[model samples]
Target: MTTLPIYQLDAFTSHLFAGNPAAVVPLEQWLPDETMQLIALENNLSETAFFVPVENGDADFHIRWFTPTVEVPLCGHATLASAFTIFNQLGFAGDEIRLQSKSGILTARRDGEAIVLNFPVQPIVPGTASDAILAALSQEKPQEVFKVVSRDTDYVLVYESDKTVRDMKPDMSALGALADRGVIVTAPSDSDDCDMVSRYFLPALGINEDPVTGYMHCVVAPYWAGKTGKASLIGYQASARGGFIECTVEGERVHLKGRAVLYMKGEIYLP
Candidate 1:
């Protein structure tokens, strides 16, 4: 039997039971895709990240993310959790780590007590949200809907208030039947501490609600920056287990900063 180190981390929050939990596994070599998918299914978190060190490259590791049901092109919280596991548990000495992923090279750096992830900004366009989508998300109408086309994430719903976003009870069956991955609902924050509030639902991805999603915020921060005329903003994901995200919109990259706490650590005995 081969043993691999596994870590579970709560990303985007300083405390446990607040942020999005992700399983991080460090491997000397990659397991089969089926095995990784099975592991993600067994973990049953929002996401699971696996990484293997690269011998020669600017990137320190090759990382991949998986949901219980499928592989995702990019995942921000899991990447942050993977970096946390590398720096804190795997004894990585560097202050900066770059990962090669399907989405391209992602960089994570230590910033005081938090990890800052540099991710590609997802561009949005005016979306064609159908009446069915409007009905599935909420009884009240949305202010607007924008599409993040490249990521398979269909619509970004702009609700009028944070309360509206928080009070939504989406039809998961209806949402899953849509032609895209999922929808993100956001609104201007009610609190002064945060500029915006959001909730993510990806029923097709087997995640009905993501607690705190840094990846979704990559699409949100830039759009809000254009609307609010602010380059830096703090967002709160108001899921059952709430969490915060610090966002800065650069030219083509979005900087996502958040804290991660170690939730569980163990050795996985693989057959």
Candidate 2:
């Protein structure tokens, strides 16, 4: 029998039962891809993160992220969860943790009560939504649409008001049929505390709605910063379990800062 330590954390929130919950599995070495996928499926969370320590001078660890149905190239919330585990549980003495991933080297640093993630800004270009996408979002028309310029497909839909984003009910079946793309809906915040509000839907990734997405903000923060002419902004993801992120856009990277809370710790038994 083999046993592995596992942790579940609510990323982007300081309290339990909020934010995006991700499972973190610390590995001594690489596990089979199938095994990791199965483990993520067993966890049944939006994402499961696995990391192995590396001696490479570039990074302290190598990490991979998986959804229940498939492996993803990058995952923001899970990466934050991994950093939290390393700092709080693993007794790492450093204030910064650098993780090498498919996306590139991601750095997480301790900032008072929050963990700040340095992630590459995903550039966006004007895009037109497909007819199916338009039909799925029939309740509210998007004022503008832009596509993230990356191999991983994502579309950003701009709405006129935060309420439209909060109350939107897209046709999941229709969106799922267009499996190649993830939809992000956003609007200027109605509340003064936040500059913008958003909701993420990726049915094809087996996540109908992500509670609080750090990855989505990589695309969102820059777009809003250009619109609002502010380098620093606060964003609220108005999902059922809401969460907030402080975003700062630098030259080519964006800093995402949020709080995380440990929810569970246990062992995963395997044969």
Candidate 3:
């Protein structure tokens, strides 16, 4: 028998049941890949994160993320949740937590009430989505479309207004067919406090809608920063359980700042 400590946190929000909820499981050593995937399936959240201590000088821990159905290369909100657990629950005695991941070295640090994540900027290039994809996405036509240059090859659709992004009702069946690709719809924000608004969908990954995505902003913040000529901007993910992120673009990196609240703490038993 094996027992592990687990925590559930609402990332990118100040309150519970608001942001994207992720499960974090702390481990002394790496578990089998199949076991981790099964654990994520049991959690049934957008993502479940697992970490093991590392003696490597480069990083404090090695982290991995998993969706309900499959393991993912990188996940933003879950990373924040893991960092929150480490800083607040595990009593980690460091100002910064360096996590080695499949996406490379990811770092997190405290900033008052927020945990700031320093992630690599996912660059975008002009690309096109199939008419079928666009049609299934929304009724209105997008101003432009671009492909994110990353491992997931996500497509970004630029709308004329925040309302357009908000009103979209994507066909999950059609999108779930494209298991390798995710979609991001975004537009300039109507509110003065927020610079942009967006939504994320990846049915193939078993997430029809991610409530608050920190990784999506890695692409969105830079795109908006270039268009609005502002390096620092705020983004609002307008999901049912909405949340906000403060993004600051600097060269090839972006700093994502958001708050996380612990929702549950318990133990998991495995045999």
Question: What's the lDDT for all of these models?
Answer: 0.92, 0.92, 0.93
Q: Write the per-residue lDDT of candidate 1 for residues 1-271, one digit (tens) a residue.
A: 9888889999999998889999999999999999999999999999999999999987999999999999988899999999999998888998999999998999999999999999999888887788998898889898988899676456899988899998899999998887468899999998899999999998887888999998899999998999999999999998999998999999999999999999999988888
Clashes of each: 0, 0, 0
Q: Model 3, which residues run further than 4 Å from truth? A: none
Summarize candidate 2's per-residue lDDT along 20-51 as a digit string, tens digits.
Answer: 99999999998999999999999999999999
- Count: clashes, candidate 2: 0
Candidate 3: Cα lDDT at 26 = 96
Q: What residue pairs clash in candidate 2, if any at all?
A: none
Please list the residue runs of candidate 2 whose C-alpha ends up more than 4 Å from where it truly belongs after superposition: none
Candidate 1: regions farther than 4 A off: none
What is the lDDT for 260 in model 1? 98
Instruction: Indicate the residue-level lDDT of 106 in model 3.
Output: 96
